[model samples]
Target chain A: MRDASEPGALPTPGGPRVRLLDADSAPLLVRDHFAGGDPGPIVASLAQVPELVGPTLPFLGAVLGPSWIPLREKEIVILRTSAVMGCRYCTDTHTVVALDSGLGRDEVRALRGDLPVAGAFSDAYERALISWCDAVAFGIESDIRPARAALDADDARVVELTLLVATTVMLNRYATALGLPVSVDARARLAEEAL
Target chain B: MTALATALADESLGGRVWFYTNYHCNLTCSYCLTESGPKVARRELDRATVLDLAREAKDLGFSQIGITGGEPFLVTDLPELLAELAGVLPVLVLTNGTLFQRALLDRIAPLGDADVSLQISLDHPDPVANDVMRGPENFRKVVEAVPALLALGIAVRIATTLEDGDADDLPRLCILHRSLGVGDEDHVVRPILRRGRAETGDMGVRARYLDLPPELTITADGAFWSPFAPTVRGGSLDTDLLLSRTVRPLQRPVDAMITVLSGRPEGADSTLNIR
Candidate 1:
């Protein structure tokens, strides 16, 4: 967990492998992401390598930001992917993000694998989504019938959702491998808010 | 006030405006910043565009104009281009000094009356040591060319690119340049940057965007952070230091640079001062 009380703090168990850039140190393209906001350790780490920012940031923005798919569905894919991969940093950070995206606390806990999905997610489509996320993350074959029916066999949505999961897995590996601590704002919000 | 306000006012590193006239060179130096050679594409900026940028640069607070490239002289209209640019601001042209033969010399004879000085690359005092990196006949061409250019009353400056091992040779190079009629003030020694062809080599230092000063550079591809910004690696243009693709209006890139500069932290000096 990161200490949220201070500005520009990175209290990972051991120090990060690469230099983390603050607003002053980050270049023009990346400075806005780190400037006067809680962008977290992921962006700080990315600022060190231009190749990371050049190819990664824009693609992540397109997938993670507003899109044709509902925000709830995208958040579910992100949370489930990070949870499946055991990326604690992303799971913890996205826990707050998921809630802000209108997901129930119990639903987030279910996505994190802390609570059972049956009781938390009453919707049949969401259950199918979680099952699909689990199968894709583990790289094992499973019945795609439930997701195909729930999504009404909409290949575009299915492809987009799957791509979202893949992108989250990519971020999950990067964040977890770097041992990025959760942001202070996320920790504080998680502790105080029941939502 | 922004952080770069004071720093931008100082005319040391990021003061001048740089233009990459083209990207095709005669020699393939091991540490060449742009990976330029006879085989490379000629991404040449025409004479009209250069003159237009020079006119706008003077209004934008640039004190001098620097023209560098695969070799500025490779462009046929460079001599006339330099004379016109010199009318707006003092012009400094970086060259290999190999093309100053009788015909080219006669063509560039008019520049003797212009406010222009040629900066020629001559790395070491020894012909063998210099040619090892810059190519054969480099030392001979530069040695013979400098006197001829000087005889025409054109000011010549010797720019020595020193690697770690070549630091000791500066004194000898200094004596050699002086004997060739170039004064100490006209001689410049700079370190090789770890860019383009020098990226994998075990010499020079690495310079990212923040590592260099914001000396607005205009190229055929785009406007970049510095003269060192527009580089090529593996036969592709490196866009890491690119600021904006718009180069016309000139105000667009100038404003973009100010926006970048305003964000610069205090005392954020360049690691490699190429003076």
Candidate 2:
């Protein structure tokens, strides 16, 4: 069986519930979207339903793309959200992105819940962000107070961070439920970084 | 050039401008996408609008123009409209093939010399089986029209809209279309989509925006996502696929579609892999 990191291999124990479409057979609009290179497994899987690509991608970009939150903080929320949700595809894929965005290996591992956050996150805001993500991901209403208090009182920052975490959580479920595979490039980068 | 023009120039994306010429047809096909029949309201795109859009489409980098309707031939001056539109870009008109009596065929015979082709619908090899979905005498009319249209030196293509159980008839349909002077290359076979009149039936495939490609289709109502977008169900138009209400400036809807396409994060590559 192909490993999780193989180009077309699904990370799930079995495989993807839906077939991924390659550039050759994908619709013209889809091909237009991934013109620079072959689409990642997440996109290819969604290509099975081409119409979803238009609405889904733009919404995904708005939620996860450049926003009021810093890249490091955004990755923190995303990693913790995926980790708590147990989405291997997103956890592994975003690990590479988090690292490329300047997150330390220990910080990345800690965010993925492989290690405790004692020394990994030195910033109070980051620590609070992680707690908020965990609280949100697990749907624990009471556990959100300490984190919300420690995080700054900037309403915009809190909302942006909350939406980021929420969107990542939704993506984690989608990627996990679909049994999407980690790309070979992302997997190689993860290995190289020893994460 | 604008972002929309640049996107349209990519041949792989299939930048075809479509016009919904009219919305009334002679027959009430069971699976008509627009629910076009003799009794349906005639929401037509006039000749001037088509010619104007064609000119704008050519300037905007669209490669071809497609004209569809409940039936395009029902438009009194479709041949002249087609000639004007074809002068701007290659043209394809979708028709039921049932309207080509001697006089109408003679009128459209001039299209043979223009950069235009007609795609006529023929669902089955057996006339009875085909007419069951398309209406009575459909198969005979298409069979007769293909030879007559071809004799006028016009290009003809046969489109087969198949139901789930109709796969067995394809080989026979191919042979039938070939015998009528249409080559195998000119035969189009696709699943009848569950839209408009076919929505209540289990005979066609389910269609959704996510599953369908974005083609800039302009109707009398507005610009649509695809020719399949401006559908009529229960005597009301389905707005699920309407792109923009203002299509006159042409840039309005083209930009709307471009805005939607630009949301893809993977970005675009340069290659005309699809035609």
Candidate 3:
């Protein structure tokens, strides 16, 4: 991720992709995340990395963000893998996002792997979906890649899942290397701002 | 299994997170870590965001919370923030104790019931001696505030940076701090680790992280895994220290924490760990 290729020149003003913002302008990334909405708690956190405003950031934002991966599937993979990997920062940061994704409170709790996945999600089909999520979380997908047959996830969906896993590592590393914490009610506050 | 291997195999990592509520401080200690000074712009977290972060941290299993700033008391909504966080996790406020007005004290005194304590700096005993490193009259205000805080039934401890002032005189200073009701055990006397504005080794010897534990830090902007190297906006130090977008539904810092905290050389896997 460190091409540092002279950091390809930033786009022009009102360009399609925003440039790497200087520290003074770092707050602009919030609008990038929210589509010109009010800023969120992430603004306070992400503004520190002015480099993210560069040519690659808008692309990286699209790849790692909520655009391609279905929020449900992506959050399940992100939360499950992060929890299983012992990444408190990721798990904490994503729990509310999972809740906001329409997962039940108990379903969210069950996804942590500390509780039985079946107890919270009663439907056998739902359990199978969760089992698939567990396999993705375990990175044991080759054994279960055949099982992708049972769900509505298409071939393109598998690619999205792979992309999500690859990006989760990057996301987790950002928190670990930089020591980012889960802001309280971050998802709710951000949701409130959107409202 | 080794501690790291076992920890790596585990399912969760709990870190105490420090929220830098604002970058405003009353005095500019020569060795201040956050570059906090009178002129530092106010970048405080709102009460909703602070409480939200606290709740999320509790679910993530954080055991402690630290409210720090140019000076935490400089934020008008601090008492309300303290009351909310004190209810969820044991909290410590790393303050200069230079701004403890009774009205502010009344609002936060109930924090004692919530496991909140003050880790106010008292680098030296005599005002003249302490003021040499910190600005003028620092020792007087902190010393005066310490006893009053203790009298309010709020737990108080003296925090000192060894690199900024006299370490040899610590025995004397600790005793003077004890006179203000800070128990001998309550003293947090340590060397100033080179960070933020003090990287030139102008403060003390560089105290690089021998190893990073699973610690979380949320500044006015985003979250991080370590607090040793903070991004000072346009400053010279490497400031690629953010982990997630507060507005999104993804995460990445904990795995990186496990790899580094496991005693592997940093950047062992990727350029993420380059010093």
TM-score for each model:
0.63, 0.57, 0.55
- For model 1, how does the per-residue alpha-carbon lDDT over B97-216 read when each residue is reduced to its tens digit? 999999999998889998999999999999999999999999999999999999888999999998888888888999999999999999988889988888746568877676787788
- Angstrom error of the Cα, residue B8, model 2: value is 2.7
The residue pairs that clash in candidate 2, if any, are A35-B268, A35-B269, A36-B268, A36-B269, A50-B210, A51-B209, A51-B210, A51-B211, A52-B210
Better candidate number, 1 or 3, judged by TM-score = 1
Report RMSD (Å) for each prediction in the order shown.
Answer: 10.3, 12.0, 18.0
DockQ of candidate 1 compared with the true complex:
0.05
Interface RMSD of each: 9.2, 11.6, 9.7
Report the lDDT tens digits of candidate 3 across residue range A1-195.
Answer: 111111332212232121223332333222244345323323424444533434445655666577756677667777766766665557766777787788766777787775788688777655666666556556675846754765566678767765666566666665555444444355344355331
Q: CA shift at B221, candidate 3, in angstroms?
A: 2.3
TM-score of chain A of 3: 0.60
lDDT of 3 at B237: 26
Q: Per-prediction DockQ scores? A: 0.05, 0.02, 0.03
Among all candidates shown, the one with the greatest DockQ: 1
Instruction: Using TM-score as the measure, name the better of candidate 2 and candidate 3.
Output: 2
Error of 2 at B92 (Å): 0.2
Off by over 4 Å in 3: A1-195, B1-14, B209-214, B231-241, B245-275
Ranking by DockQ: 1, 3, 2
